[model samples]
Target: MIGLTGSPYGSSFPYAREGSFYLSGYKGAAIWFAPVPLFDHSGVVSTFRQLELTKTKFGSIIKLHLLSLALLIVFSFIFYALIWKLAPIPSGAYPFVEKMWPLQATMETIWIKSTLPGGADVVGRLIRWEYISAGMVFTTLLYGGLMVLKAPPLLFYGLIAGLGTGAWIHYTLPTFIGAMLGKFYFSKKYGEKRWRAYAPVILAGYGCGLGLIGMAAVSLVLIAKSTSQILF
Candidate 1:
């Protein structure tokens, strides 16, 4: 129940996948269960023996974790230094922008809502300009984090996810264009009255066609890459 509902930051309900029931909470916390026995009687005893051996090695484990944490801090500092060095030197443009009252007020509001402690309730609203600013900030941070860690693009959805409603603007534009075209076509082919109902359907169909084509192109690229690697 705690795993299912308590950890709202990033929690998952207990779910069955393959032979296991998996539950996760917050960041890296997780619990999993396998219904089927993973080991025979002898194997279970061997596992117990291995557990006993682990007790004696606990100090080594602690040392290894500390070393890993130290390395992570070192790498983070290095990345920060590199980013600072590579950053463009500020020009007179900074002072020019700073003097603009409207722009300065807007920047102050964004900074306070984003950085300060309070304003959680306001920010939690479904839609707001604050959300858009937060999205942009998070996306930039995520990109830098991925670069530092040299992680895969498997979490590419994260970039889109953070953008909230803004992410759909591109997709929405195409659909709107399709809807306009559909309205005209339907009005001409059927009747002016019927276009209201049929116009949206055309856009839906148009969007689906585009999505399928995109998926197919991506899949073909992945398949070709895999096939080449296998052959070589």
Candidate 2:
């Protein structure tokens, strides 16, 4: 049995014990393991110290990224509120629109539909729309927040990297997979319907546009970082 032990004052696990272990080291200063020697004690301690340093650096990076994300979320929320409040009101049949509609339109499919389909559908649609809208709003807000937050250049670059990752994983790949699935599953069912036949093409085009936007945003962010550094 290999047992792990951590430093009381540090985050690193510096000691490992085997079955029937009973060992001692410098009191309150170093850790000890007994019964089986899996590694050199001094070497293990050094390695643990290096790992601790690395972990500290990584933690700093994560904290910076999270700060940027939060800033983006707040900015996005404010932007959404402003847009919703300043936009024109719909007349007659259209109901009062909320601040989250733009985000919902981009992320939620049910909200894309014009007429209500059936029972409890409105409630379900609203819930999904709110959840997705919140996510989109959060991501978009973070993109702008990084600049205002005075984050490190690397942090801004990381945000762009994350956006690129999201565009490919969330938008482009899904669009491709959705198109393939539609062709495989619905081609036979709706082959004669012109709208159905063209749906995939339209979706693919939308995905391409979104992907291009994401790429442009990434390039702009990188360029801004470089220019700022050069000017300063």
Candidate 3:
């Protein structure tokens, strides 16, 4: 709406077209950052998400925040339990947990600061069902493995989560660069008067091109898989 990433609702300058819902702009902004780690990364993004949450219905906002807090508590407990069970972590447990507590508390503070109105029905509807399903499956498998088999916690986090973190950064970097380049080029060419109007167009073009390429890639992969199965 305003950059490579969509702008928030009622955003200033080239104001985004109003959607049917009040949070439509906020939803766009959230989805724009969906590729990145939700809990980690830039404070700016975290702050933005908090702002976006404010567009949700008051009741639904409270519920979503509570749900997030509960999940965090459960994850913290699980991680601590795993640490307790680990062969070599007994001595380091206190220091590790102590160090992590501040971060956890800060996240809680951010979550609590958020407020919303008129967003109950759409609270969880923004995210795609497939993403929710996949997240559930992944969480179940990871926890099941850790609890049942006692897989090393570091191994799970380091390999899988680490890769995911890297992938999201990689996916987001190009778009960010494109937006910056657009800003520079537009400002230089159009001068102070008109640059802002065209900068966002560059970001839109990048997203559209990437979307087409991604779809084509997925289509090819599906076709190849089908053909291989038929041939073999």
> Candidate 1 residues 17-99, lDDT tens each?
31132111111112222145542243344445665777646566579779999999998797556534532334332344445
Top TM-score: which candidate number?
3
lDDT, candidate 3, 18-76, per-residue tens:
22223343532343223433231333565567667777455775798899999999988
**Candidate number of the best lDDT:** 3
TM-score of each: 0.24, 0.20, 0.26
Candidate RMSDs in Å, in order, are 23.0, 25.9, 25.2
Ranking by TM-score: 3, 1, 2
lDDT, candidate 1, residue 99?
A: 59
Candidate 2 lDDT, tens digit per residue, 50-154? Answer: 658777575765797799999999988975565445435443212444445655554333322212234223423344567668867886787578768876545
In order, what lDDT does every prediction score? Answer: 0.51, 0.51, 0.53
Q: Indicate the residue-level lDDT of 227 in model 2.
A: 49
Clashing pairs in 2: 72-141, 72-142
- Candidate 2 lDDT: 0.51
Higher-ranked by TM-score: 1 or 2: 1
